[model samples]
Target: MLITRRFFPYFVTQCLGALNDNIYKNVLLLLVTYSQVNELPISVNMFVNLAAGVFILPFFLFSAHAGMVADNVDKAMLIRRLKLIEFIIMSCAAVAILSQSYLVMLLLLFLMGTQSAYFGPVKYSLLPQTLKENELVTGNAWVEMGTFISILVGTLSAGLIVASDNSLVAASATVVTLAAIGYLSSRAIPALPPQGKIEKIRFTPLSGTWRSIAKVRQTPSIWMAILAISWFWFLGATYLTQFPNFAKLHLHADATVVSLLLALFSIGIAVGSWICERVSYGHVELGVIPFGVLGLTVFGVDLIFAIPPAPVDLSTVYSFSTFIAASQHYRVMADLFMVGLSGGLFIVPLYAFIQSRAEKGECAQAIAANNIVNAFFMVTAAVLSIVLLGLLEWSIPQLFLLLAALNTVVALYVYSQVPEFAQRFVSYILSHVMYRVNVTGREHIPAQGAGVIVCNHVSYVDALIIMGSSTRPMRFVMDKSISEIPLLKYLFRHAGVIPICSPKQCEKTYEQAFEHIHQALNNEELVCIFPEGRLSADGDIAEFRPGIERILAADPVSVTPMALKGLWGSYFSHKGGHALTTRPKRFWSRVEVNIGETVNGVELGRHGLHQQVSELFERKS
Candidate 1:
């Protein structure tokens, strides 16, 4: 639904660009692989590696400058120019193919890579300019889905064409046509104004790259999200690079089976990317990221064990149908599919968040910085795989288990670095998986600046529900006991939740809660507190505690009253004896959060705030 006039053409342009890049690359790969003419001094393997290196080297060399150029110029015109560059590069590639000149083709590959390098920052940064905040996730989802599907199509088509007698002619014509179409699509993109005055261009890679990275680091949330995204690429490169070996050495499968496994993985990612947007329901729901990481790890570990001992007759290669005939082999493919699916879930939101959160002028630079880090991670994955599988003599399955174990470490590290990610994951699960949550008067919750959200604490997950409903990050001042819940403790701490207790019970915690509240408010953050101090035993509003008064007295900010409806009898509520012991009566009930108008903190006394919250609850009921 968010795919509007500008976005549609932009999306098609990017997809076609990717398709053409891969078509050319894969065609060259096939040429070097099966061509029997001993025309050059280099081995086929070396030539293939050289081609791969040439294509990606530009991202390392030109990304920083590309990012700056995108920031400095009108994006539509820049894209059109890049498309023209792509067309010229492909035309040259076509001539190289016609001449059967491998060296000329390699140079063209580098030129194509340079064109792509310039395209990278513009592609990502353009989304924030062309789409609204709510549309970011959907836009990113479409981009990712298109890229993966294009990869599949391009690779398959290149393979098919390479088998024909006129391989060069077909591949040459295909890339040129795609590039011309990409240029046409670029012409249809709407012009976007320059975000900020572009600074003087710095062509030096080391200095420029460092500047871009520093710009990204200026925003901690953006930095962490980029890291998480890069980690997905790391895991992806590791897994995909090993698939061919795993299929051949472990499953004793032929080329067709290997291609099948890769195709399944690509399809799964596309499905997951689309599913991420659907499940998120127009929100940049980061709550699903951890769930995705869990799926990836669980499936990665499972795949390691799913492979049986290598067959004695290693020479006998099984076709795709024959390989998948066995249930175990099918399970291995399923695991691969899930791994890719989880990767999609893990990456899409992180990308969207960076786009949404980044400062306007530096967005393109930030994306370029992300590209640099992602490239680093991918190269690291490849090197790590080599060390484990070649030098260490570890089997492909063992390498997978090792990588899965390492992924757990990386996920935890990133979550710790940015607790918002963990909080969003929990909120996403609650909002999308456990319940259908609707928030009325979300606009009452300010998009920027500090405020206090006073809400009834009806259930253990009430905080998560409010979090999922509101776009801004909130620091909830919750009961110390609730914050100590083992499953939620880390999530609570990382979310910057202020844990409190009565002065009589814990003078230290009470003092600390006030201190945290002051600090958070001073930093202009939204803080939520349930003045009741505890959950209701019966489905009634508990007496308001004086803590809200204390918080406002210290920092008198606007206070918004909110109520949770339809969660009174949920598993985490006190309708049953103890919340932990209560079984969930309903899994996917509709929960509504009714947010009232922002009342002046000084004007509303404890009784007034209490009355406001009570009215909200009653109205929803």
Candidate 2:
């Protein structure tokens, strides 16, 4: 699927927004600490935190309205307006920095948060309308990866600028420049209108919020999935907020070390997100979430042990240069990479799941609900982190261990509650393992429900190859004798493959196969049968059998013809006069499975169907 013209501009806008948010927020926090050291107290910390809360508070209060606006108005127009609002907010922040007014800066931070609140719902909801279902996971991955990298750059700028002698002037100039660039990018986005009109414009905020929440709750699996996503963000927020303290107090590291840790985490997330699109065959695979959570827990605990002892001189301030010279830098880098890697694995799938499962028109509201939950969880994380560090007297390492343990427990609980997640995991592994297969033109098959697939008989492994490549599950028809192959039998049985005998040899077995095909199609299940009926005797396309036509006539479904190339020499084939070879040399062989467009049963007679299948293979050869 193509990335819509709208995505590029939206990506840049969000990137700039993330950068601006981090740069100002981090700088303000730094100034409060360094400039007013003597006056920096618990009250000051609370006030600064309150500033942070004000930004998130808008998401909870206005997200429902924001979602409505995105769904009701033209998206490109909405984005243009939001970008204008961002310009004003950034201008205010620039002015606040120029005048050295902390009060103005705090207020501007709140405004920035409010702008983001409005953008969040529109950003996600637009994707489904613009991109195809298969592209959703890949598209979401790119956005997430981009957002995290932008945060890294923004935060890095904040640290460097705040540490400079002329911090105020530097930061003010940076914010204005980024905001201007963001606005220009917003102009490039193409127009996208709401798919359908929403009738309730005068709806109460509470009712709208509850109704959006109800949409998610109606699908229990989706609800669980959303909770899982929120929990991930909560853990992420906790880790981010705690990093500086964790570095300074626990690892005896300096600001540079802390920055490196953050960068590594961001990089890992970016890499993982990009990989998710490629690895899952462009589908949202929930299996990766458990793997991600496992990494988070394991590496999070290991990071604690990896921390270096406290420095000999606790009172001294270290420069960025000095921090790089520290002994624990390598250990810190490893831990952060793992955290980010796992984080990437965790988030991309959840976003894809939300996009895929949520009701079509209410996508923005679903995302709004997600943002609300995210904000609430972040608040909870902050409280939890503070309690763990202060009241519980837990060392940073111990806190890391606790977070890891919690991840494991929560992951298990989620998988137990939703077996579909686990089933996807099994499917993901099966596709990747045994052999790597590549399929093309799979989009020709209908997105959902039952269809008949006809293919040239190549080898015993052809069914497995087809199963591995198909996005949807398919039942295969196989010779009864080969179907009994030990290891192959297990997988075939689990996959619901049917056994068939030649009509002349065993009429009952052949009749049963036809009945099974009819039943499967009736239940909206894809049934794949080799019309050639047996392995090719001379490594060439065999004549199409008449049984497939009977199956199609009985079921009245579209027939998809496919050809498996480069498998003629494989051990599984009958070429070597051996049924199965002990040492198969086939590794990384290039195999292409090409699917043809569906042929309407109404237009094609039995002989015509056979001819169509022959023509498809003719082109493939």
Candidate 3:
């Protein structure tokens, strides 16, 4: 996909933009941090945090209008235009660097931010419009990979150039050349009609801002996803904006050392993005998010302790080579890497989730609202750091400690609001780690619309395995007894699992279960039912029951026949006395979920479907 005309150009353009942004921004930051230029009116800490706020302010101010413009125009054309604006901003930045004008550079920060604010909506909205459903996760993964890699290279470039002779000329030349190339790359991107409905081009920024946010709020889950994304930026902004001062003050490091830390952090995110693509299995998977959240707080707190105390000599400074030479510094590098890695895992899925779930017509607006919130949080991060570090006299490491604590609170709240994230996290760990699941015929399960998935019930954890196999949420129709198991019950119940019973157990419960299944199917939800009506107690396929026929008669939706293989002996299965009846002896078992072609129109009775499933099972997984 990256080699194609459709995606590569856009990728190049966006990456170059991120590269140049970091280069120019860091050049200014390094000059101020090292006191290479005329003394600033404010302290170095004030200047760094102030620069972050200046750059992020435009996103808050103009993102709504930008989102509307992106949706109303051709995204390809808008991208090109935005790139051209970037070129002009770089031109002015070049002149500022040559003249050493601190205020001019600061003003250009606002202009650069304005260009990026406009570009953000177009960049995100363009992907879902241009790519296939399965490609969304891969695309987001690649974009993140490119963005962070560019940031890494740019940061290293800025550090090395600042340390070089004729630094001003080199920095000016670099930003302009990159901007021009980014503009040229934008020209090759294939044109795409805007994905949003053409609406009146409203010029009122305040009203449009509210309008976009209101659009996002229409879906509570999407809104929560946006907030989660925003919180990530908040944490990211705090760490990135203060990296220079943090390294200098805490580690007693030079500019080269700061570059090394940023490089490790950036590469970690890129690696995590690549891993997200691999683990996603050609679709966006949300299960890794909680895993990411765990790492963010864990490594973030560790970083505070990982730091060496301030040097006894104020003049002492560790260069990149010296910093890494010591074994103690390895802990700091690893901590930074893990924080970035977790952030990548946490961020990519939320971006894909919002894209897949947001209202189609308002997708861009939803992303715009995300940008607005992200900017708000990031700006707040900047301000909060100033309050903590400057006014309160807290150390940079102390600020990091605060960030980790806040992240935990924020994550718990989001999990409360959006329980599916937590549910998928559990399923994700179970399927991806405890059991290695290889799924075939994933395409047979529709990306949208209603479908019935009837799989042979091999274990009590069948619902979780099937849920993890799917990209979309699957509403499992399960036995009341299994569904009510104390631990699994809470996970399944809140996840919308439908619990059913035989007529003898409770006539009303039996009737309501079918009603709920019908409602789920009518709502275009994927409904999975174990037609065996119970787990295979003897490690063989049980004869499917007639309830499947009742479901088909009621909904008449397409049925996807799936087979769960290699799960008979796992702890959750009946092979070892009883599931969870004794101490667990095995884990990391290999399992396969084979999805057969969707059979529709003609009624396939339970027996017929069972034959197809059996045939699927017979095929080597």
lDDT winner: 3
Tell me the deviation in Å of residue 403 in model 3.
Answer: 1.9
The candidate that wins on TM-score is 3
Q: Compute the lDDT for candidate 3.
A: 0.88
Shift of residue 605 alpha carbon in model 1, Å: 6.7
Is 1 or 3 the stronger prediction by lDDT?
3
User: What's each prediction's TM-score?
Assistant: 0.89, 0.80, 0.92
lDDT of 3 by residue, 1-621 (tens): 878888999999999999999899989988877755456778777787688779888887899998888888999999999999999989999999998887789999989989999999888988888888789999999999999999888878887788899899999999999999999999999988866578887777777788788888888889999999999988987888789898887888887787787888888898888888888877779988887899999999999998876667789889989889978789999999999999999999999998888656667778899999998887788779879988999988888998899889999999998888888888888888898888899888887899899899988888888888887888999999999998888889888988998999999999999999999999999999999998898877789988999888988999999999989877788886888685666789788899999997236798899898998888884
Worst 10 residues of 2 by lDDT: 427-436
Per-residue lDDT of 537 in model 3: 87
Across residues 148-176, which tens digit of lDDT does each residue of candidate 1 receive?
A: 89988888888899998888889889999
lDDT of 2 by residue, 509-591 (tens): 98999999889999888888887788876678877777876887787888887887767777778776754863576765767
Worst 10 residues of 1 by lDDT: 307-316
- Candidate 1: what lDDT? 0.86
lDDT of each: 0.86, 0.78, 0.88
Candidates ranked, most accurate by TM-score first? 3, 1, 2
